[model samples]
Target: MRIRGLTVTFGEKRVLDGFSLDLPDQGVTALSGPSGCGKTTLLRVLAGLQRPEAGRVEGLKPEEAVLLFQENRLFPWRTVEQHLTDVAALSGGMARRLALVRALALGAQGCRWLLLDEPFTGVDQRRAEGLMEAVRGLRVPVLLCAHESHTLSLADRVVPLEGPPLRRREGEGP
Candidate 1:
């Protein structure tokens, strides 16, 4: 997706200012920054969960993308299989079981463009890698917010955010 002259504010804090980015049509892009740097806010804007005060975004369809928030957001009482069925509407039988397997492997399923926030949370390196592999298997655009360098490295391109005005660099380390 392409964003131009984007601005977002939360109360008195200007999370993003005059930010712009052009994402590739395919492949993963990693967003990295220190805490409270507006990376998550940017993702929300991109996902259409939050609105920007002023900006223009093109080439993204709201219905086709799925966002995985920083928190798991899984229903506390729902089993893993139930969660996938709830979101993707895959009922019992081979389809539901396959979706659950995919989600368990990648930690999410059925999203064309997966927006993952801190995907590695509460998981070991091996499990995280398994999840990452599942994400790779989807062969879709993946946007990730990451604190670890190794996790960021898995992305096709890494964008590092610094301060307000939301400067971005391609293939840079935070």
Candidate 2:
């Protein structure tokens, strides 16, 4: 998807000012920046949770995308298996491999673009790496925001933000 001259503001402060970006139709693009650089805002806009003040976004829709927030929204009372079963209803009952379950049934939800915010939080680095590899293997495109070096490494491209964004850090080839 492509965002052209997107702008967002709150009160007197500006969050995204004529901000723009182009996310790939396939593979992963990691949005990297400091604590308050509008990464989450951009994700929200892509997920239809927020509307931009100006410009246009193309190539994706609300139904075509899913945004995984920085916090784990899983029900604490539910077991991992239970959560997996619940998700299976969305992902077409894809078989289980390892326990890395976040990306499990999202595909079945018809989510073409997986937008994640610090998806590996609380997970160990080793496990996070494995799960990221699995996500990379999926045919669907991915757009995520993270600061971890490992997560950044997993992306097919990295959009390093400094203000209005900058050039993309091309990953080690697709």
Would you estimate the TM-scores of all the predictions?
0.79, 0.80
Instruction: Give the alpha carbon lDDT tens digit for every residue of 1-174 in model 2.
Output: 888887787776677787766667888888887877788888888889888888778898877877776655555566667877774222211222222355546754566888888776556678777777777666789888888888788888887775433223345322
Candidate 1 runs further than 4 Å off: 88-111, 169-174
Per-residue accuracy of model 1 over 1-174 as CA lDDT, tens digit each: 888888998778888888878887778888888877888888798778998999888877656676667755445566656765665333333332344344444433455577777667555566566767777778888888888887776778888877654666445644
> What's the CA error at residue 100 for candidate 2, in Å?
7.6
Error of 1 at 31 (Å): 0.6
Candidate 2's TM-score reads: 0.80
Query: Candidate 1 — worst ten consecutive residues by lDDT sum?
Result: 88-97
User: Candidate 2: global Cα-lDDT?
Assistant: 0.70
- lDDT for 84 in candidate 2 is 72
The residue-level lDDT of candidate 1 at 153 comes to 68
Q: Model 2, stretches more than 4 Å misplaced?
A: 87-103, 163-174
